[model samples]
Structures are given as C-alpha cells and as structure tokens.
Target: MSETQMPAGQLSGNVLFYSKPEPLAKELHSKIGVKRMDGPFKFAKVGHAIPLTVGEFPLAAVTGPIIFVGDEKLPIAVMGLNAGENMFVKDDGTFESGIYIPAYVRRYPFVFANDEQNNQMVLCIDRNAEFIVDKGYDMAFFEANGEPTEYTKNCIEFCNNFEVERQRTVSFVQILKDLDLFETKEATFTPANPDGTQGETQKIAEYFGVSEEKLNALPAAKFVELRDNGALGQIYAHMHSLVGWDRMIALALTKAAAQQPQAANA
Candidate 1:
C-alpha cells in the first residue's frame, strides 16, 4: 500500500519520526541544500520513541527497552517512558554519549516513500528540517549540472538499506504472530518515598512482547524451522532486551522526581 493510503491507526502519518516527508525531485533540488549537522541532534527532540530496524536489535537491546508497536508490530527503541520526554536526549538536543542510535532516527530528514502507481519506493526528505539551506552551504542536493551529489546519493543508499531491514522486521514479527507468541504486558514502578519507605506502585506503560511460555511450547518441528530460518537469535535478543525495562523504570523515577520537586521533598 502507498504511504498515504496507510491506515490512520498506523504510525505512517506525520507522527512517525519525520515531521514532513516530501518526494525529492529535480524540480525541488535547486531549492534544497543541507548544512552539515554540526550541533547536537536537533531533529530528534520532536519524539521520544524511535523506530528500530531488525538488524539493530542486538545493539539497541543494550541501550533501551526494545518493544513492538501497533498491529504491524513495528519495533521501536523506547527512549522515554513518558510522553514528551526522552531520557536519552540531553538538553543540548544530542543523545546521551555512547548510546546506540537506531538507524530509523539516524535516517532522519530523509526516507523512502511508496510509489503505489509504480509499485516502488521513492526517496523523500523533510523540507521543514532545520538543516535545510537555500544557499551559502557546502552541501547541495544537486550539482550545478543538475545531478545528485555524493551526499544525496549516500542518503538514498542509507534509506534503501533501512527499507530492506524494515521489510525483514515485518516478516520477523509475522512469524511471532503466527506462532501466537506475543502477549500484552504492563510495567509498574514504585519509587522510594522521601521518608525512605516504599511509595505507591504506578503502571508506567503497556506494550506487546514475546511470551516465553508460548515459545517454549512450540513443537520441535516449528522450533527447527525458526532455527533454520535464522530467526532464533532475533527472538532471543528481543527477550533479553526486556532486561532494559528496569533501567527505564529507574530513569522514569528520576524524571518524575525532577518534575515534581515538592512531592519529592514531601
């Protein structure tokens, strides 16, 4: 299906990472130039969650909670447990040092849009991006000869690679779904009170994750199929990523306390 034809419930709209995705064409190339991203990550401040391609699971698992979203089971690295807050992003707009940045976020300002009529994907960019420049910039989308530059070509290649990984992730999630191994789960956190006592437990978020029980119950034949298909490692990575939930809770409690100092002091 074309991106525009994606269902409202899907995360394809302006809400899914990119703010405004417009096809990059020769007609628009003259008006577009991108400055080197010199400062912190200004583009990432808009959203707390970043999408994850299947290949990023192992590295992302070490950085944050990796979970699936919506019916499509799109993988995402949870940067923050609460809305409008990202623990990984510092005040300077850069991610925390040494943390893994998902390719979906790194591919920011550029993406591949589905060309439904042609049944293919086209390269697109966010015109509203701050790094876009009209003139006096070393970076240019196209040369004076009207050919795409190395920078634009590199972006296309990156987007293409991400698209390939995204498709693989779709198949991975489908396998889990078909096996009925996914289950809904909620994470609760209880912070220590100012008096040095345990406080009330609060449910932080709800999400879908793999069920170990169901996976273990799978027939030996099915298990062999997953192993032979090279999906077993990914499944194990996802399950192991759940260990980051505790880290998320710790970060959330710190943010909560910082937001409500009075309660924290009480």
Candidate 2:
C-alpha cells in the first residue's frame, strides 16, 4: 500500500504524509529515533500537491508551478499532472536529486500539533513513519539525560521555522484576497496529431491564480505597499512558476510513453 497505516478514527488534519502522529515525549519515546530506510518517502508517491509557504515560492517555483486552491486559497506546489503520480519521486521513493524539495516534504515524519487548551504547539511525529525506529538507530530523539538530542532539536527547530513561514504565507494570501487579485484559471494542453496537425486543447486542472490584469490595475498606493512589504517578489515568483506547467506536461508525456510498452507486454 502507498499510504501509511494510520490509527482507526484518527483525524489526519491537513498533512497528507503523516499517519499515526503522536506527541514526542522522553518518557514515551526514550528510544525512538530515525534512520535511513529504503523507500523512506514512498508514502508521498501518490501525492501530487504539497502545502507551500510564501518563503518557498522562489525556490519551489523553479521546480513546479505553485497554485492557490479552494476557498482557503492555500498555496500548493504542483508536482504531477494526474492523481497518484509524482514525477519527481522515483519508484524507489527517493525524490529526484539536484532539484528543490519543499520544506513541507523535508520536515516530514515530524510535525507540530496545537495543544488547544494550553494554547501551545506540541512537537509530534508519525509513529508509523518508515524511518522511525528503536534505539541504535540514527538521529535519536533524546539523550540519556532526557534532553532532546541535537538531531531532534534540529528537527524541532526546522518544524518551528516551517510554522513561522506557514503563518507568513497566511498573511500573503490575505493580502491577495483583500486586493481581489485572484482569478480562476485552467491548465490546458494541446497534443500533436499523428498527421502533424494542431489538436484540440485539453484542460487538465482548474485552479486560482493571481490575475495579472487585476495586479496591474491595483491602485498605485496598493502596488507600493505590496512592493514595500516584499509580497510583490513572491507574487512574481508564483507567476513565473506558471511556466512549469509545460514542464509537467513534458514529464507526463515521457512517463506515459514509457508505460505503453509495459502495458503492451501485460
């Protein structure tokens, strides 16, 4: 199975990769740690979209297009053209090397859960993560004295940074929403006909994007505010990332061509 074995009746919240998340505690997990595992990222193989922070737009833009989705206008990095297909992730579960990987994916197996009553965030881990293991494994969660190990502290700090970026993304989205800059858009592709004629354009996805018309139409004062606050750069990053749609289409065609022979054999 591609997905993790989550606990029955457990709410998954928003993260698609996490399953069986548990609060990390020295008492409960004194021996728990992470180690290199074959197919460590296989759980993410079927996921085409991952949450993106505003901080990631520039780097993520180069790899794949970023789009806003749903009423929330949540930003996501588009990694594949269809469901259950991640072009960047090899069959062995290792994401393609020499390409930008989102912090959302790198921080996996560790996440934060809000302690609602305490008004605090608690560090949690996917109890069923393939890398999680007993003692003698790499990157132990705690030292013998019960303090968090350096590795664990680093992971926690990374999660904390992600939370900060995530909050910043919320503000960015709010600004776009207040400016009414969003436009509904569709991803389309036209395949070449066997006779070398132009084919009808096929729509692949429907999503929300920053409307260039709306952006250019903004009041001068509003445009200045966006630039002064650095949102303009991120907006441009997102817009530039739109070109990655063509890259995705190319990868999809390549993968499809490779599969045809296997299908014929079967």
Candidate 3:
C-alpha cells in the first residue's frame, strides 16, 4: 500500500487500550506484565480484526504499546474508531457472561463513532510507520534495545496447530517472531532435498526470494522447515524491499547456511 492510498491527513496521535484499571476488569493487569509485549498483535476485540479509515481510507487497526490500564503516561495510538459493544451485566455491575467491557465505548475516543460498538481495540498511528504489516497480523511493540525477541516455539506450534502449508498458515506475527529468532541468534538451519546439489535448493530460496547460501545458514531446523513448507515468501518479499533486493538475497543465503543442518541425507 502506498502513502498516497492512505487517508489524506497524516495521523499523528496515540491511544491506550486495556480493560479498565479496576480490580473487577476481566483482563488481569498483573498478567499483562508477565507476557512480554510482542508482535503480530492483531487489532482484535473478540479475537477478530478491526478495519477502519483515516482521512477516509481503509486500514487495519490494532493496539500498539499495550499498557496496564493504569499506566497512562506512555503515548497511546488510539484508533480513529470505537467499535465496542455493551456486555450483559450482573446486578453488582460486573459482566454476567464472563465477557469484558472496553474503555472506548459510548462517546468513543477513536475517530470513528461506530467503532465503539464491537469493543475492538482500534488504534490510530500518525502514519504507516507505526505499523509493521504481516499477512494478517500487525506488530505491537518496538524493543528499545534493538530488534524484538523471537518466539520460535510459539510460532512453530501456531503453524502446526493449523495444519496448513506454512505459507498459508503462518500469520504476520509468526513470521516476525521467526525472523527475530534468526536475528537474535536463536535459529539455525537450511534447505535439504532429494538432490544434494545446493543448486537444487535454489527454488525454495527464491520462493522465499532469498538465495541458496542464505537458506543454508539458519541455526534453527524449524526455520528451514518453514522455508521448505513455503512460509518464508512474504518475509523475503518485505525484507527484500526494506533492505534492498540484493542485500536481502545475500542475507537469506547466509542465514540459511547458518541455520540448516550440514549433514542432511540427499
């Protein structure tokens, strides 16, 4: 998507999202602290994505820099729309069906008034720069130290849970974690097949849009497995564009060599 296709005015604001800071909130404040703030944080209210417009154009919206309800000091990228809905409540002012209410309901803080109906966590960023896109996921946090940490096991398990080919099954968040695994030195492995020649491995590498050498260098076998399963294409595409086509190709070859097993049977 091009900048021109985005809404006319540059969005330059933020919003915070969480169950209210009350003890009665369904989402626990303490648990949020334990789970490392990570990516592929899709804009979900009821485990579903929210779609809205900024300056009159449509885009996927999600929460970013998620904070405990009480921490309002940090910048918030509030969605331009409020899609929260009313939950069935008990006499004591608590929800009856174990569902949670959103803070952005009613006179929604988001730019869109309709957004308040579904309890969706739609956030507004100043630009596309705030978001890191994936096939269907949106990134949520940026690590000040550097690139975010990888969740390799979570990514692999998530893919296997779907039973689809990795290309089709993996979401944007899964790929981000997988790549993080590589950057953080958690992954190692490369391609293997009936043909022993590394040249034969070039297709999967190209499918990832990386090169033969890069596909052979990853430290994690699962990364190769994902490549072999066709999960690396979109990642390769994005990285290639972000880092330059040639540089990304070289990086891929190097990573594949570093991560793949050297002793695979031909």
Considering every candidate listed, which one attains the maximal lDDT? 2
lDDT of 2 at 94: 86
lDDT of 3 by residue, 1-266 (tens): 01112222322233333221121111211111112223212223322112211111111111211111111111112221123421122323333342322322211211221123343322322123212232333322222333221432233233233223222323433543444422211112244555864423232111122233454566678577667855555334323332222333454466557657764533
Worst 10 residues of 1 by lDDT: 1-10
Candidate 2 global lDDT? 0.86
Q: Model 2: which residue pairs collide?
A: none
- Clashes per model (N, Cα, C within 3 A): 0, 0, 57
Q: Report the lDDT tens digits of candidate 2 across residue range 49-100.
A: 8889999999999998999999999999999888877788888888888567
lDDT of 3: 0.28
Better of 2 and 3 by TM-score: 2
* Descending-TM-score candidate ranking: 2, 1, 3
The TM-score measured for candidate 3 stands at 0.20
Worst 10 residues of 2 by lDDT: 1-10
The candidate, 1 or 3, that scores higher on TM-score is: 1
